[model samples]
Target: MIALVTAALAPGIALLSYFYLRNEYESRTFTQVLRAFIIGALLVFPIMVLQYALEAESIFEAEWLHAFVGVAGLEEFFKWFLLYFAIYRFVLFQSRYDGIIYGVALSLGFASAENVMYLMALGIDSAIGRAFLPVSSHALFGVVMGYYMGCAKKSDPNNFKLWISLSLVVPIILHGVYDLILLTIHENVMFIIVPFMFFLWWFALSRTKKANEKMA
Candidate 1:
């Protein structure tokens, strides 16, 4: 039982820890971050219901369409909504880096819950694979979303629209590609997930630096 719990939680916690350390502002309280994470985990229930409904309706028959529009689109949009509505207007969101903090908190929350479900159903081997892929993939998506959200917050009123759009759109694109590659899962295409993950890590780290610079 302990091992299962650890398998369920470790990936998300590790990713969240890394991002928490990256947060220079440290303006948000632990309670606030916990609230964001709880909100995100709570949201998974509804999202899963929707995804199951879609699968029941055979909406996932077209793999690319399902991976991109259905799965990635639905997941990212809701995650975006959770961040935008739950924390975007909060007073503590003063620094540009706050978005990344909140974004990772929420995204990791979702990932943790999702990871538990997969681990329970598919066993530890699946959990091991997910730790390296799905959990971190969601974290990368969070970084992309948060970076734009930070920009949106700091941008001129005229540019707010563009940054806000990117906050939602970029994650959807990255998530879509990530899911598509995994869904395809061919011997030939298997090599692609590696380079893609590397790029995601590099991109997320660069975004963190940029957000830190904005804070400075």
Candidate 2:
């Protein structure tokens, strides 16, 4: 059981640490990051309940709708809400890269919990795949979300709306497409997913670099 828990959480912890420690300009205290993580972890339960309710009601009959609206929409919306309301105006959020740090923390928090539950049901053999795919994907999605959020924080009133909207919309779209690909492609899913993952990594790293450069 202990091993199982460790296996489930290790990937998320590693990713979270990578993003958190990469900030050179201003550092956020552990408490601030942990608070966001805990809040994000707590979000999984409500989101699960809501998803279950949606499923029970047959609210979304089509697979595409379920993937885009039911799953991606709900998950990203709550994460965005928390980032915008709970962490946006934080005292330590003075630096542009801080958004990436908090975003990664919250995302990995949720992803870690979700990964644990998934591994418990599917067993340990699935851990590697989950780590590479779902967990990493969540972190990348957070990068995209956080990048725009950081922009919104530093933007003028005229541009604030655009950045903030992209913060939510971009993640939803990327997450939705990710789910759609997995749901629709049964055989050789990795063929498509691999390239997609590569794109995510490149895009996320570029965003990270841009945010860090802006800090200078």
How well is each residue in 1-216 modelled by candidate 2, as lDDT tens digits? 899999999999999988887787867789999998888889989999999999999998899999999999999999999998899966456666888888888998999999989999999999999999999999999999998998887656689889999999999999999999999999999999999999999999998888887533
Off by over 4 Å in 1: none
Tally clashes: model 2. Answer: 0
The ten-residue window of minimal lDDT in model 2 covers: 89-98
lDDT of 1 by residue, 1-216 (tens): 779879889988888888988777657788888888888788889999999999999977998998888889999999999899889877466677888888898999999999888888888878878988889999889988988998888767699989999999999989999989988887776589989999999999999999888532
Top candidate, metric TM-score: 2
Instruction: Report the number of backbone clashes for model 1.
Output: 0
User: Once superposed on the true structure, which residue ranges of model 2 sit more than 4 Å away at CA?
Assistant: none
Give the clashing pairs for model 2: none
lDDT of every predicted structure (CA atoms): 0.87, 0.90
TM-score of each: 0.95, 0.96
- Give the candidate number with the greatest lDDT: 2
